[model samples]
Target: MFDTPQSTRSGATAPPPASHPTLPADRPGPHSKRLGYIAVIATFGGLLFGYDTGVINGALEPMRDDLGLTATMEGFVVSVLIFGAAIGALIGGRMADSQGRRRNILMLATIFMVGTLGCVLAPTWETLGVFRFILGLAVGGASATVPVYLAEMAPVERRGSIVTRNEVMIVSGQFAAFVINAIIFNIWGEHDSVWRYMLLVALAPAIGLFVGMLRMPESPRWLSSQGRDDEALEVLRQVRSPERAEAELAEVHALALEEKESQTGGWSDLATPWIRRLIIVGIGIGVFSQLSGINVIMYYGTQLLENAGFSSNGAILANTANGLFSVLGVTVGILMMNKFNRRAMIITGYTLTTTFHLLVGIFALAMPDNSLKPYVIMGLVIGFVFSMQALIGPLTWLLLSEIFPLKIRSFAMGVSVFTLWIANSIVAFGFPPTVSALGISSTFFVFAALGVLAIIFMWRMAPETRGRTLEQFEDDFRIQHS
Candidate 1:
């Protein structure tokens, strides 16, 4: 079995406590304000992630008018970014592990800016696809890196809420995109090329991430992993209460020392039984989160609205409600993360979302083609979005950040999120055509079926990751699988 701290052993047989990461009593105190600052800056990675992906939802129609896009081309445009993200998640995870999280994020920020500029200026649909892929790399990198940075910087107890701050930003970014797209489309609906303006908004956050990260501290856990214990503790003191910093450092130092002897973080480590199980869990979380058919809505909500009978302008405006409620969902989600059990929350979310998907299908199938159909589905879609953002969405990222040991955390996360992107790619590429050929009712039924599989997999395979240190959780996995 892998090594574990003494205090965590009592948790082995019982389902993990509360599903929230709270520090031991003595370790809680007056943390530095820098913790809040760091969360804001680093999570811009998420904001950009949201804005870039969500922008395309409203832009696709105008781009089709200008570029003469076939349905296949539209699917390709959306899925290419996701495919690039799969590659990025893989590469970025390795980079975060080897290059240091702060350094990796700075590099990603630069890529985000360059990629955004490239997409904005692309002369053709083909050119736009290439730049979108580049931007995907940055999004994937940020997804794998930022949460790790936040989790490592935070006090043990605060890890749940702090790490999840990125999820809130991601949805908020999407919300901003929807709002911006609506406003711009309303003001400039006559222009075929106005999609460029919609995409341009992403540049602001990409720049913010680059500038803010320059002044931020490197992750203390990452420093210690590199045999820089003194530097790790120094970084820790910036965000933590002095006494808590010292205490956390001792724990971090012990874990780092042990990791150096035992781990060589790479794909080969998958041979280890516990690590393999953990990787499977991570990948499942990523895959199922998307299988909830959430991104399909994020990517195609305006189209779906149009399909249901709204005009171009009306659909774009209606889609903003989805964005607004997602932001609201994440707000409530962050607050609830402090108290809930992770497994229970996810399971409940899955049940409700699956039911909602089924309802959308039924409503689309049974409700006569009329004005009321669109609003009813929109209301249900809003509920589905809320359950996803509030219940399963943030925790997906939080559990990923919390469950893995420090050495392999990013690598495992990269692999998992890679699958997430790939799954999303399938949905993106498949959704438009599916909806076109089969109509909305059958398309949603397919998603509902997929949701059932995700619920089963999560119920049986996913772990509860609350109320523990990184070292403690790793040890439990090791022991459980041993």
Candidate 2:
């Protein structure tokens, strides 16, 4: 394996790659500002993922009332997109690996437009569900692709912070969805097509992503894999400063050659012990992230609040609080991410969330069934959201982006994220029924048990990957498995 000279900054030794050229401290210039814009554009996919998944929380009830949906249909509508997302994640991963990350994301942007259009125009619940599933395909693909794209292109110093920005955008998108849902519902409270309007707002960002990505560069790492080093260098120069970009491009090219000579790029590559172990770790992180039941809160917070005793409008308004807190939590987490170790964050987050779940379950069970009980439980639920957003939420995506080798980064993350969506689908599809049959208290207790398992699994399997470069971490992971 080729190794680049290391530089120690703030107690962490950075691997070969320097800070991205554009943002180098030696000279602050226009390139730095432009790179920041590019990061925002790339993260638009994350925004759409957040908004599309979260809109269902407030829109589902109106949609149910409008289309006369039953419990099964309700679950179907909510989870159908997750099914499409699963397939999209798998196919998008392969496509991102084979095609280019930028191209695949642009294609996803178009799919987002189509899926949003379908949902907006559908006259029946069946049609809306189908459209939602289609939308999910795009969302899943974007979720898998965007983070990898960001991770691959980001400089070593900023990788965690940059990749987690996608998480921030995701929660921001969810917050936007909640706010939009509330505003639209409040204005057109009795309108027949209010739900349709809720679904349509996603188109604006979908269009923005499609247009913005047109001017963006492809992943330089992907280009290097295809033996297009010159193009890769040029693209790197666009994002990095000239000196650092040249140095980083050389390092990337060297690694590409090493990986090419080994020819370990696919299913067969995974057979190697080190590669296999990394893949297992990658998948474990993805599964544990979903097993936290965060999506259950995002997709069904309104309904969960309603079950806790809030009225319809009250539920919608209260759910907006969930979205806002989620965004806030993610912001706080991202700020702390660069400052702390990844393993510490994950362990701390899971511990707090598990404690919240147990407390919430106990509070719900013990509190009297008065109006105050609902508000108190809702407060606990909000606390749970805060805990999740602040810790596990961003850390999960950050770790997935960090753990894999470059040769199979897209494929590995795709498979891992695909598993995440599948896990998400299971929680989403089963949550309503679980609540109905087992009641909210028992349902959360089950998640609490899962959370405890996640904590143990993480402690045993997850590495401290916060400040390491992808290349350096790859060597460490290889040694660990060996």
TM-scores of all candidate predictions against the true structure: 0.93, 0.93
Whole-model alpha-carbon lDDT for candidate 2: 0.84
lDDT of 2 by residue, 13-105 (tens): 543333433333324566566667778999999999999988887788788888899988887888899889988988898899988999999
Clashing pairs in 2: 21-240, 21-241, 22-240, 22-241
lDDT of 2 at 388: 92
In model 2, the runs with Cα more than 4 Å from the true position are 1-27
| Residue ranges of candidate 1 with Cα displaced over 4 Å | 1-30
State the C-alpha lDDT per candidate: 0.84, 0.84
Query: Could you give candidate 1's per-residue lDDT for residues 15-92 as a string of tens digits?
Result: 334332333343433445678889999999999989988988878889998999997788778778888889998899
